[model samples]
Target chain A: MNVLPRRQFIGQCCAAVGATGMMSALSALRATAAAASIPSGNNLPGTEADVASDYRALVCIFLNGGNDASNLIVPYDASGYAAYASARTALALPQSTLLPILPKTSDGRSFALHPSTGELKNLFEGGKLAILANVGTLVEPTTVAQYKAQSVKLPPQLFSHNDQQAQWQSSIPDQPFKTGWGGRMADLVNSLNTNSAVSMSMTLNGVNSFQVGNLISQLSVQPASASSPKGGPVAFARTTGGNNPNRYQTQKDLFTSPQSNLFSSAFGTLSSNAIGNSDALAAALAATGTIATSFPDTSLGNQLKSIAYLISAAGTLKLKRQVFFARIGGWDTHADQVEADVSLGAHAGLLQQVSQAMNAFYNATIELGCANQVTTFTASDFGRTFTSNGDGSDHGWGGHHLVLGGAVKGGDIYGRMPSPVVNGPDDTGLGRWIPTTSVDEYGATLARWFGVSDTNLPVAFPNIGRFAKPNLGFLG
Target chain B: MKPATIYLAVAAGFLLLLLVLRPDAGVATDPRSPRIAAPPAPPASAAPALAASPVASEERSPLADGLNAPAGTVDEDLRIVATLIEVFRSNFPRDGNPTGSNAEITAALTGRNRLRLALVPPDHPALNARGELCDRWGTPFFFHSESRVQTEIRSAGPDRKHWTEDDVVTKQ
Candidate 1:
């Protein structure tokens, strides 16, 4: 009997208002609207209270500082290994140390995971994780010859850190950064929720470029800490007290006040909504039972635990759809790529953290019984140079990424794998590769599975039309 | 002479003739050989002259651009320009930030011969019309001297536009 102590129980009560409170608020509001629209005399079909029956979530795990993915997914076959080693020089992983995985496509070409990727290997072998090869920001479908010739327009800011990361989320590198695909998707489908005031997109990280939309800004929350406003109605949003009810009511009035200025009015409305959402979500999470799966104490692990709590509360909150964002930084390994033994270093540590955290998150989804309804994917700024600059590699384009869920077609690699040919057909010169698969194709596939219609797919991904295949077919 | 002795002598003479002639060597005069000559080696000409350098030119000259290209290519002409830029940046003040003018910085180098040899290479393009260091697309590299310990170096990228998507700047 593992009994939660009194202080620990109080701490859990304080932490009950998890990340996706805004989604729940919106759902509640939408359900209210549906109920209101029904006529008193004539009994029309009222708002379906069970909209939560078809709950789904999309989680985007962004690896900051441009994760060097050339080493993440490696070639295991003899000929492939030789080419990779020759090109990478000192930075290549030893063939003997790699963890080989049986890919579905057995064309005499096999691949192995990074030595630190044992957890991810288990997920792959268990048919729950799929690898998307050589994917990156692209304006249109580009060929090697066209890229070299500059015949087709290329993605903007090919290697700049901020710009490339922005493009990975925004999908329009040439233009300015204002909105991201996640926010756009939320804008397109958020109306389906009965609640209109709360946004469907939520972030554990503070503010980000990924969830910025024209109309719907994502709700922000800290995974381990409360919102902790300096002095607002939401500061004690989830707290129940009657000592100074006037101060709380005064703050609430300030939040709901309609200022003459447009911006002030909007801010007031948003503040009021935040307070309302905090109170409701706190009650719902308090009533929800604990999850059986335990996550690590790492930052990403804590973020995933918070997301699991939010997913479990989906039924209570009446949320039909949701998108959550979580991230971890410091993957930029320009120095000290590995120790002399070639076993552990900064990059390997990041890989191990990602593997363990993702594995645990998947287990949590299964525990919640929504494993098939939710999907998780990885995104990065860009791949790193295959060539080593003595100690480490430089920033590059076109990287391999991971897609994991129960609905994913696992044990396979989607898209064309770029040949590890430095200065050969695939390389530009210093081991930077042009992506064979575009971001449009990747995002469209995920959006399609998220219940987006073909016609409205462009709302989420504007340039989806340029690519021939919007869906990459990884989803079931 | 006996018939056997005559036949052995004839065979020996034929072997010696074959060795001396060497018909398979593929000399043009040997009618039995193929007509074409061997493939040419990659040209490694000396750097172009100083006066003809792009820095001295009235108009910006366009060179090839492959600064960020991957390896395994035979026709990448712009790598030399990128390599030279890397070397030039390495020659900055010890603290990695330079406040002095280009001439002052060039003179302060401890190793003068290394800079002199690289500053002017024959047949090596990448000199803009202003005779300054630029990328293959004629985009000039700007050296902003704001900080005392560090100077900003950036190249106007492929579109010949400044501060756009294709700009390549030094890591701060």
Candidate 2:
């Protein structure tokens, strides 16, 4: 062997230990023999080298509680408004308050967004956003007649909160919860992130099904708060530099020490990995510094701001493809959804929060020169009733959603817009519109844009083939 | 004018002053006391205007007398329960607390906490052994929360089983 100096030998040993620690921290995400069996399929029209060189991210903003979609994307034409106003008597917003939009191609009807969603309207007019109408969880495509006749399978527990939320996140409504579509997508494309130490999936909201995967688990990060304004990895208390430097060493030793019991051994390994991961992430984020773009100080704004920071550090973290999850609650508007003015209340406040935060996030992406690379989409448990129940609406089936980015074919409404009439052709009963487009179709489109191939689309969304259009063409 | 007529007018004025001064002169002194007759129901047009007003009304429904005196239809009983729950929710607007389950709601309404809002008396017949608000059919009413404030009250109707055609439902 070649002779080496004492200093060189010590440096090499330290490097070896550090590399081992990083590998152990990300042990779950390593592409082992078992993980190699997962179907990645062939990437879309691109070589592996091309895909590895590029970057893209999918951000999911899950609005907790069933949103009232009837008032969200309203009909603004005279006759359409007449029907909407007739159905939603006291809860209807004034026609003058509605912010009208001219779709690229309309289905013989004009539309306006909720008065509170002015930013969304701006995005629509600027050709950065597109609306997908009447999308919801479905076993397969079913019409009002089939729904009434009970001739087709339906999503289990249609109106309940927890069940519907799981169904929407999983995108596999027919089967019991196995994994979220986001998680599955991450698993398939995780190879793109060649040298990443952290999981490709990160969540601002703690512990969601959307980011739970088989190989790569979600990493929960805190939003910018008063204590830690520039939020990063949630570190353990006093685990770093302190007066008791020996204490940190002792704790690390205890965690990494071998154990006889299986449970203790597992716990020790997890704790050691957590410490290593947190330190690695904190260092990466500190190196990336901060972006100059200003974000709002609200709950959702803080989450999106944190996400923007994380995206800025994607290169430092060695991530090529990433998925993020954020959530905001208080959308369950059973009563007090609107006030006497019909333009302000709980629902309006929530919508404004969503609009402002989303707008800020999109701007931040543009500032980072990744506007065309990142796509943000909105989802909720389900839609609310079209017919108002005195002051608010009840749980319903289908609802509208917003998809926006620089690459979107925006300023247009896709899918079939249901008739506003209660008990109409689209309505099964009580204005619960049967979904014309399934969640599988919507997710498949996003997966395709995120670089998932046609063959691997089924791996992410098993029910995608049941739907006619896998690519909705909203994304360019 | 005669001096006697003037004295009589002064005496009537003094009596009216006494009537106005005495707080208990017009209405029943005790809130728990039975009223001779129920107040007329407010019109449909007035409902929205009075939506945020106080829950205490001059009208006495079967709910005030306890479920033992329930002589109304299932639909009427459900409405009464829903109105009571609505009043409870209005007082405590905090989301997800004391609204998750029937027992929690019962605890809040029956003065088990610091607020001490005796919306439903502890010994009322509407409450079962478990302290849940029961329907006229002697079954606990299912409280489904659409949100923190809005709840759907369902009573297992005549058959005393839930999710059936005869079940009575009301959203508040």
Candidate 3:
């Protein structure tokens, strides 16, 4: 592998910080010291050559942009199917293109998927994937009339992307919050670990609002590669003083300087932490062994592959708990959503890639013997409207999401499926359905099953108390 | 007293003390840590009125407090525009993509108190795709995009002195 240059790495850091403007002279000195102190081989806590492994992790795949779910998981019953077809218009997937439906006895209901998701069908039938329908941000249990009359509060900027995305991740639609439900859940269970080499939260997609914690920050890693400050060892080693080592010494001196302000101190601390975490991650990666599972080579696939690689290395990291964040975009299909194959194109194509990769990842987890210990779930900003906006659907509230793993009560749909009519009882003026189940309820159930105590549930999900029941009964 | 009998009696007493102390020593604390003092709980009565004025507590959210300035002050307007800069840098296809580290960015912003640089015109190269002006915490201000120029304006007009919350605030 080609090594990243030291000067280039410093330049990138400079630019990143430069986005707001250049850092002070003192900050540069501290950063250099932190960079030099990065841990070397065998220095981390868990990688002592050999160790036994038994741990579990959850990987969350967030599909950004309000994913049009009406076309993703369709109603298969005769009446419901017809209503969906009528409302969706140009956006509807023909019955012929849908993945085969698995009829369930509980609600006398059956569902189909866009033909692109044939791989997903196999997993569902094999009892790996469970669907949750009509879920969105809610402060409390609300009705359409109540929503229209403003009797109860709703999430801020209901149809906007950034607002709703933060709301979904934080479970606090009332404002923009950094602590996601996942990060908060990590906060509760993070202290249980014996190893301090790795953090509870890791993100392949980069720094996100969802992975932030009050005290602990998420570690950002590259997909399928070692993570550092961009440029290689030499770049990191090159400092500002006369000799290579001089820069590091200068930086250390600056951080420890009594004259330094609180801001300077904080900058020194964070930069040092970043370098420390990166070095630890590199060491952990070096000590990992390969797994037999093969993931698809797509972007999402590469991300899952990294996640799998990390899980395979869990022994070396000495982690009892971990949360991985992965994301796939391009779901904002405004026009010509049909694929080149016609039946297997656009939105359908994206779903197929999602299903195939997930199924493969699930199988890999099983092969690794951590299948039951690992749970994978999906989340999105909001669901698209039931009615098609010419070629695609517009942004709407309350779309369906999926959860997959050996531990999930799979092979069925949870939550009330909204009527697929243009102006049904659940509709709020337009075709957007009011969510019967809050995002808080859905997240709380998962967090509960993941080992978060009932007492800590409110902290992970503040709005959970506003709902009648916290758990959605998805975990088996 | 017989020496062997005295020793056995002392050992028995020590064992009893150990057994009595062990249970209390091993007792579990509340399995969950007490909540970090969050801002006082939202009022039950106020819950119903959230729809009327939606953003009553937007400033208090962790994202707002940790990442950007609270959204009302001139500092906030500049910070909002900087968000667009962050987004543009993240979205740039060929310049080598990075997710933009929030911590590092935050440090960079705080290091140089450039929190009120929004008075500068949009034409400056510093406002370009990769080098956009950020708030004190390195949050790139959010703005609507129209080609290269981000459509967000910090001030209402040339004066920028009279801008209010009701003024047109661009969304990314």
lDDT of 1 by residue, A1-476 (tens): 11133233222222212222344334333322232222223321111222255777899999987788888888888999999999888888988889999988765778899999899999999999999998999877776766654556666435556667889999876566667888777767777665543346667765567776655556554474333211011133322444366767887798687799987886566455545555555444444566667677777877777777767755555567888889999776666777656558888888988999899989988877778888999999888888875667767788999999989998899987788888777776567777888888998899888888899998888888888889899998
- For candidate 1, give the lDDT: 0.62
Looking at model 1, residue A153 earns an lDDT score of: 62
Candidate 2 lDDT by residue in tens digits, A49-77: 22233789999999899889888899999
- For every model shown, what is its TM-score relative to the native structure? 0.67, 0.70, 0.65
Which parts of model 2 have CA positions greater than 4 angstroms off?
A: A1-53, A239-246, B1-172
Question: What local distance difference test score does each model get?
Answer: 0.62, 0.71, 0.59
Instruction: Name the best candidate (by lDDT).
Output: 2
The ten-residue window of minimal lDDT in model 1 chain A covers A226-235
Cα displacement (Å) at residue A229, model 3: 18
Instruction: Give lDDT tens digits, candidate 3, residues A334-395.
Output: 45666445455568767877988898889878776777778899888888768765556656
lDDT of 1 at A100: 93
Give the B-chain TM-score of model 2: 0.59
Location of the lowest summed lDDT over 10 successive residues in candidate 3 chain A: A227-236
